[model samples]
Target: MRSVASRFAPYQELAEHLLQATISEPMDAAHDVGHLLRVWGNAERLMAEEGGDRSVLTAATLLHDCVHVPKDSPLRLSASSMAAEKAGRVLDSLNWTAGDVEKVRHAIEAHSFSAGIVPTTLEAKILQDADRLDAIGHIGIARCFHVSGQMNRPICDLFDPGADRRALDDRAFAMDHFQTKLLTLTGSFQTATGRRLARVRHDKVRDFLNGLLEEVLPDAMTVSH
Candidate 1:
């Protein structure tokens, strides 16, 4: 309902900068502009319902992936960090305050599951949950498989034999994303509203995983979507 500019001019300016920078990247699957917008949309809804700060949430959403590279690629991760620094500079150019920029930048950097950056603020948690939510359900499945293709990782039933159960490895981020970020998001949400949404969305992915696992046993490939 209410637009961003009428609320906080500084954050809205930073968000616009983030938009231009992220859109310039060579993103295809998980990090695309459409996907980022979806996460921000979800964050907006949850933040409004939960009474969190909308401007900060929006800033986190836009900047979170401005430098996000694939989890397994160390080179990309380094590149991502450099890009994040550049994003900070971009924000600085907009005259955003040091405190607000630090807050936004920390949330952006900590939003990654593999990075092990835990959320300490409601804005951070909202951003984390929104990003995590995108990694599940129908869209999430497609993104996961798409990511697997990018990583050249083998496809495996996430519920069993092929899914690596090890903890927090970036190479396993594609399919195992369900476990690392998606599933964990169920509890990590800062607000009750987020937990509710996360639980429902989380169930969709879990059910999807179970159905896929059942099909993987044998003679089930003929089942249609």
Candidate 2:
């Protein structure tokens, strides 16, 4: 708990208390403690510029994935709301005020794209932006492949890698996800800071996809051509 608290300054005590009280077991490589740290780091960066409730954002980030659903699960859409509900119960057990708990709960639920929630609160917006930041950059690239491997999905369709003839299906090929979701995340960011950061990561994804195509394509482009 101290180590976890150390990463979240100014809210070290709150982080420690929540860390001790929360009963979250590790879910997957993509949503592990490292993922939490990355999202919290992003929230801190966003808050530095956007201005939000530090306590609310901190609590939301810590307990956001307390309930985990697999990326391939049919229940993926409900994962965020489920997490939010469970987080509310956890906060209630810890004697948190109902208003603050609701704020945290809303942030957790609205952070998910699958949840289709429009973030109404500043904290919810911040959490959504912060969480999305982790889904696009080099870290996002690593996590994408990691989850792909876990799901037993191929990196891409070698013969028709760009999905020119068919609709994008991320569930079938990992690379299709770039077109279906990852590349589109920049526009969906709720905060200006998140959008700014997302552009840089977004470029990295494009570069990576280009490189991947160069390697896998049958008639790879040549320098002279």
Candidate 3:
């Protein structure tokens, strides 16, 4: 099927600009705009398979994380509102129509799992799926550690939810994320395509965690890293 990615003129044009802005920043191995684009690409594929309102879903998927501050950053807990605020200003500047802009805002605002905004539209759900899908595999693994490192979270934080959540310390947020959010996304995805892909990506996360525990455990043999 032809990609629905190119149908929305303003989003496409603005996404290019956002891509430029993100790429201009010197970054390494984590939640970058380049990765956001890939997430959007995957979202689009799922959208095509799931068959939803392409325009809104495409726009939402592309912009969902356009304003994220960082990996495992507190934004994972607190940024959706901020991202919504920023996205609103951006849509207004682009002269997007009121209705389309509202849809965009709704999708962005509702995309966060932590934000707990229940999705009211198919577009919102797809964007949520796409964003989470990006958080699951190798790219997901790399980004997770990178986020934890930035937060100064310990390697053991992966299994400790409460400590990570209460940490208030950005350093401990990554583990909180893995325990409370990242691993649970597959179960929460709203679409068939999203659910299926999430299952596969989630397995990668599951295996990684199990392998880590086995390797690191004193009785299991030896840890690789």
Candidate 4:
């Protein structure tokens, strides 16, 4: 199996151009270039297992968050749409074919959880799976806290670490995100490879949450008196 970078070597120039643009754009730590690359890498792995239009998947992954909105902004739900519009312009500048550009745009538009757009094409599904994959595992944990810190959200609610008693408010507590989104992603993947990988990553998150509950919940941590 070819490495992600090597498999996508043909589009490295375009990828680099996109990377340069992403670096110059103002984005939160959770949605930066590193996050983009991770998503692209995930796309590459998924694409290998599930064949799709590599050009569309690669371009979509690179430009997915180009027009990022703040997590708490009213425009948050529309961020993917905004990115799709910006990506179309960028792809036009790169002289990509109309059909190909449209495919890329649709993939970007449908990749976001908030957008709630069902992906029709295989490339779009791959892009969606790839982006969501990056929101789990250790990196996902880091990103959750990073975004939490940016939004002034706490790491966990001391009394309700799992958000069992109250409505899950990820914007107020990072751990609540697991119950709200991350834990639910494994069942939402669009590809077999994505589902396979998601299950592993999901287990990691579950373990972390269980450990956290043990440490934070008084009953869970009780010792014989």
Candidate 5:
């Protein structure tokens, strides 16, 4: 696997500068360097076919999560906009053109699912897809539990793990997130490549959810009886 610096190619210096400056701050396990690299990797795959400005995509992908609000924070919905604002400042320091800065800002701001901003540019669409791609499949499985642990959210509701009898609240149960978001993400892909890759990863998530249901549901039923 390529290092995050190597992934940026001719723009590696820019990536390195931000990594040392902005990215050096403390972050949760889910939003750390590994996540950045994975998102960039996903972006590269999408760019290979979707076609977007590499320099802008590189900067946006690197700084997309520069601001990390806790998942439960009231500020969570604005996290992407805040990150975009910070990215604009960082790029201004590096002397990027105002137009280019705005492009990066839009990509970063629209990339968040919670932010609910529709991506208008190809780069923004690609960034959004790439970031979301990291939220499904096997890696996504690990990330999900990692975050749940961090927030002390339970893996499921135990007696009603599937929430068949209760309201769905991902905040209270990690498994509920599958129903609320992760499982439905494939349909939300912005590009053809992203959608194609998403279908494959979506299956992995479904299979994992199925396997978990098989193991846990019966046990819960047994305990309830």
Candidate 6:
């Protein structure tokens, strides 16, 4: 796989400047600069194979989380829409062509899981899949716990880590996020490469979950001793 830096070589300077100016101060760790870079890297990898308007995808990735909403806020679902509106102004300030700016805005608006808008363009789909990829696997695990901590949620449910017998409430327990969102991302990917990569990452999540379960429920490992 080519280095993500190489993929963003053309847009690196602009992306960095825009990010510095737009990303919220005291950002949520789950959606920090590191998260933006990972999402861009994922977009590059998927775009390399899937093919799309690289400029639009790149801009969308960098600006997707420009508007950060608290995890527990009722407006959480509207973050993407808010980001899209803000991104338009930012792109215009940079003198991006109006047409290109609209494309970027559309991609950003549709990228959110809560937005419920199907990506109508290849660039939009790649942006959506790339962002979602960051929410699974090893990086996803780190982000899950990071957000959980930010929201004052426990790392796991001491009694039902997998939510087998209770309602799935990711807001209350980080582990419930796997079943609530992460595990389901593979099938939600738009591009074939996204799906392939998501499957590999998805397995990593399964491994983590299994390990956690075995540690928490040692009797599940017993053989009638």
- Ranked candidates, highest TM-score first: 5, 2, 4, 6, 1, 3
After superposition, the stretches of candidate 2 with alpha carbons farther than 4 Å from their true spots are: 20-23, 218-225
The residue-by-residue lDDT of candidate 6 on 1-225, one tens digit each, is: 123334467876776666664555458778887787888889889888999987787788878888878878899889889999989998999999999999999999999998899998899999999998999889999988888887789877788676667898887888788778888788899999999999889999988877877787764321110
Clashes by residue pair, model 3:
151-171
User: Which runs in model 4 stand beyond 4 Å of their true positions?
Assistant: 1-7, 220-225
Candidate that scores best on TM-score: 5
Q: Model 5, stretches more than 4 Å misplaced?
A: 1-3, 219-225
- Models 1 onward score TM values of 0.77, 0.93, 0.75, 0.91, 0.94, 0.90
lDDT of 5 by residue, 1-225 (tens): 236687789888888887764565668878889899899999999999999999999999988988878989999999999999999999999999999999999999999999889999999999999999999999988899999999899999978998877998999999888878888888888999999999999888888887787788764321110
Off by over 4 Å in 3: 1-12, 18-29, 70-76, 157-177, 218-225
Cα lDDT tens digits for candidate 2, 123-182: 999999999889997988899999999989999887788887678899999988888898
CA lDDT of each prediction against the hidden true structure = 0.65, 0.86, 0.66, 0.83, 0.88, 0.82
Lowest lDDT 10-residue stretch of candidate 3: 216-225
Candidate 1, residue 178: lDDT: 54
Off by over 4 Å in 1: 1-15, 75-84, 157-181, 218-225
Best by lDDT: 5
lDDT of 4 by residue, 28-62 (tens): 77887668778878988998889998778778887
How high is the lDDT of residue 99 in model 5?
A: 94
* TM-score attained by model 4: 0.91
2 or 6, greater by lDDT: 2
